[model samples]
Target: MSQVIQDKVIDENLKWSKINHDLIRTMETPGKMWWTAVLVCVAMVACAVAAEIYQYKYGLGSVGLNNPHMWDMYIATFVFWIGMSHAGTLLSAILHIIHAQWRKPIYRFAEAMTTFSLMTAGFFPMIHLGRVWNLYWVLPYVSDRGIWPNFRSPLVWDAFAISTYLSASALFLVIGMIPDMAVLRDHTKGWRKKVYGLMALGWRGDDRQWRNFRRTYMLMACFLIPLAISVHSIVSSDFAMSIMPGWHITSFPPYFVAGALYSGCAAIMTLFVVLRYFYRWEDYMTKNIMEKTCKLTFAIAMVWTYLNLIEFSSVWYGHNVYDKELLIDKATGPYAAVFWTMIICGMVAPFGLVFQSWRRHMPTMFVMSIVLQISMFTERWMIVAPTLSMSHAPHQWDILWGSVIEWAIVFGSFGWFSLLFLLFCKFLPAISTYEVKELCFHLKHEIEEEKREAEQKAKNTSAAGSQQPVSGSPGLEGA
Candidate 1:
């Protein structure tokens, strides 16, 4: 048995080594379209920087904020981005707890999206302040006035929740990358090797190191599950706690969480499709993985749809004059088109995944994911704009449209995110090479074990045949 185990180990190592060689060669080859993508991302950043400078020179008045609709596109975009971050934590932490093998390839990119989206989302509240210099006043720290931030304020809760989530996500990203960083360190040379070597923290594939690493990762996964849920809940509370019409529903927390996960799943799907094709990870990120992702997106999209219906029903049935009026205005007023589009894109189009073909086809799934993301953005806009537009005062019921500068900055944020992701792929192993190798090792062992069992059965059969049936003459004489 000991010898059998040793042989199995050797076989597994050889199989994994071959796979690693193939993976290295594929990743080393740059695609012809890579530079085109880089150029587009650069142009987007430049456009965004110019727009931001213009906003700074002209002031917040240049954008779309008035008496009632103070929180316009910027706030909506912020919420959308923050919600997008939830997918990473869900995939990494929650799925890890459940031991989903498919998550191994997807989790790294998802976590990166979470970290970058959180960073992007952090910018909005500051930009919304307009007088960004006084941003520190939002903190609970001691001020010259000797007053703390209102403990009961939802905005303060948002500040605390977002900060905590960002910190946790950063830590999660670093921890997840450590093993892969060690792989890079082993494979690289010169400056790249030194950088990865330092980041790897002397990981040496020792038994003790593996035990501790797994323990740390498991603990982090446990912590992140609740953190991800609470972060989105807190974000929802920002509006739910408000007494404004269309905002005070009890369903807001779960609704927001669902929306977050819905958009997040879509974003993950989009990124996975891109990465699978761009990195040529057709073997690792299989059709089955894409189908599973789409299934999740469809499930969450249905939940979001149900929540929307419930929200509308509760408001309509309660017969609160303010809530009814706001609902009516949102459904029939100037923003009616956006509201319907949100429903169709967010809730309706995602139903396409019910078809087996749609789930299997990467391009179709990719388009569906993009539509879901766009619709989710529209949902965020609906949440913020409709309430702020149709306030208690009749005279303030003006439609708020984002300025050109606002659009530029928002588009730039996407550019920034894409840019970071692209650079990450170029430098770091986007798919965890070591993790894949480990899986390959396990698979190899399983295959070899089956082969050994089959060989043993064949040998036993041959021995029995020779002993009982080789010479029929002696057996017949005895009979």
Candidate 2:
């Protein structure tokens, strides 16, 4: 017991200095490229704001809203951002539940992605609602007119679902950061120390604090998994609950959920590569973790492929002429190019990950991630636009594309999300410090155990060889 305790103490001490030095280094002022990127992102966001202001002064007509195709790029962008948010929670919360120790090194930035993506997603509904001032009316609160938001509406469902998810995800990200913040607090001096100290919630790393922290974190993780699942499912209902033939499918919720996880994993890789290059964290963010993430993404991609096939097959094989016509229009009409790009990127590109060596190739993975990002965005757009463009009543049919304001808002959302993430890197630990130490502890033990086993095998072989064999034994001559 004494030896065990001593070993634990030594192991804990082993990683502290290196972990602190490496992680805190990310918070230091970055290079010229980073600043350049920040300036570009800020400028783009300014342009987006200006575009929105113009749209506000004018009307929804600025986004080319027609009778049949009212939902355009705004709704598509909303789904895209919402899907991006899912990977973070899956990386941190679900992996934590499964005791995936490798998640420790990468989950911090992934969860940060979740929090920021959700913030970006929250912008779309207000954009969709031309009278953005009445945004609060979507809430469940009672008003002076004794009115309430219609609970039956999927839009209301989206309000409750997204708000709940944002709150829980924010809590999850902050709570997980506290212990690492405390580590930062102990190491820093003066102003930075005080800042981390406050953010750490006075974390002390005593037995009681750890106990409470673990329990609370576990409980929150349990809550977030279903919440994450529900948020996107509700987002799907905005289309599925509608009476439109193509939109009224039972498969949408699970399909949306899978797409969310699929795109999310790709987004993580995108951010992972950027940060790894800039921060020089090649050690913790190793090739093996990247390989695992790629493999997971490949699997989700297959799942999404199956779901996509199922949607198309169901539409074709079933007796619904309206759905079949919409699907046909999406494949052969003006949007055919978008549909094929989604197929090639979303379905075919992931197959490249089947080769283990290819998965380890960083540049290959990065480019593939970009492809998936485009494919996923187009997937959401195709889901919304093509079906609406082809109404059951021939007279109601109309082709529609997003306007300049809509395109500006899309670009702006990307800039806004990037700005938040860059600021996060500058201020907080991009990688979790103490969690890396914990990972170090487990890996150190595994290495030590393997060494001991190897030594024991060598000893046993030596002892057996040294034993005098009978003269008649065939093995004696070789020995």
Candidate 3:
């Protein structure tokens, strides 16, 4: 009899009941390490707030913005966080549409990351605005004096894109959580039950409810895929629409989208390892799934690397003196260190995943994921800084090293994201309970089918053997 082989996305022996219990337990327990992390995140957020206050009072100069280097770390950090927000769309929307079962265990946290990163990214533009009070001026609304914001400015595009993407992503997140909220509502007590009940919208898990849920979820996933793509493309247009030498490239949109997906995937890997180890979810977040994630990340890394090389090649050969000069400056000038770091981490480092052992090794994958993100962070910095430093007019050239306030604000943004995510972990299920149960159900069915096939094959072989003639007996004479 031939063996039927299948790679499990989760442990084959896990039961639906246990899947529910363990996932619920994740929200119920709070250990010292979690509390300590929350406290540290709070402190970091406080520093960021203090820095923003100082900047608000003292004007943009507090963060070292000047004539040439008008945009600095704030813009870079904005792009970084915005890129990070793509992870949820890639994991949740794209994978869901394709019915990728492995994503079920990890997509919930990735969705939350999308929302929180968008919230963090939204802060940077306001912080960049020296007149924070006039934030609404960027809106398309007209003032009483008939003054309106610049219609063609990339800032307006960002305002529209960010708001739309944020609203859609937040809605998608909440909609996806409803069934889990219903589970929590039924299982919990006190204020949590009440909160979950309200959040659940009185879900009964009846046939009609599930049918509608499936339909709505699929629709949202479909809508979000293109929306996610467009959002980052608009962000890229913030540069591409500009006449600046390096920023005005035609390839910037696709380049930005690829880079965003690459960074987002890396961020997901980092969190995947963290949640697996911290929650002891070896059965649910199995190595098979991690390996698949690594493979996808590796593929995206290659796409991003190709795009990077294309940009360099185009600039080098296109006979654009300003663009070529700026490219050379980025490679050989003060920012060369950061430029090469991006190249190594974003392009070369992902090749480690080619080794099956490294991809499955959680600790190594975790470190590599963080390194990839650091590379992405430097990439955004390189994008902004080198362009501004190598401006068309040599007299306007200046490199912004950024000030302490800028650094503090960027640091705080991380803390803020962490704090929000921690609260999400406390109150909400990081793993999709119903989805994990679905995986368990499918795995059990597959195992049973394989067993039945093997048994049937064995019985058939025995019967055939029983009917066959012996080598030196009556059956051989009959044959």
- Candidate with top lDDT is 3
Candidate 2 deviation (Cα RMSD): 4.5
| Model 1 lDDT per residue over 73-184, tens place | 8889989999999988888888888977567766888988899999889999988778888998898887787899898887898899899999999998898788777877
Q: Model 1 Cα displacement at 262 (Å)?
A: 0.7
Candidate ranking (lDDT, best to worst):
3, 2, 1
**Sliding window of 10 residues with minimal summed lDDT for model 1:** 5-14
Question: What value does the lDDT take at residue 473 in candidate 2?
Answer: 73
lDDT of candidate model 2 versus the reference = 0.88
Candidate 3 regions with alpha-carbon error over 4 angstroms: 1-5, 457-479
Worst 10 residues of 3 by lDDT: 1-10
lDDT of 3 by residue, 1-479 (tens): 32323567777567777877887888876889999999999999999999989988888875789878888799999999999999999999999989888898999999999999999999999989889898988876757889887878878888998999999999999999999999889888899989999999999999999999999999999999999899999999999999999999999989999999999999999988988898888887788889999999999999999999999999999989999999998989999999999999998999999999999899999999999999999999999999998889999887778899999999999999999999998888888988888877787887889888889999999999998877776655544
Residue pair clashes in candidate 3: none
Candidates 1 and 3, the one with greater lDDT: 3
What TM-score, computed on C-alpha atoms, does each candidate reach? 0.88, 0.94, 0.95
For residue 415, give model 1's deviation from the true position in Å. Answer: 0.7
**Which 10-residue span in candidate 2 carries the lowest summed lDDT?**
1-10
What is each predicted model's overall lDDT from 0 to 1? Answer: 0.82, 0.88, 0.91
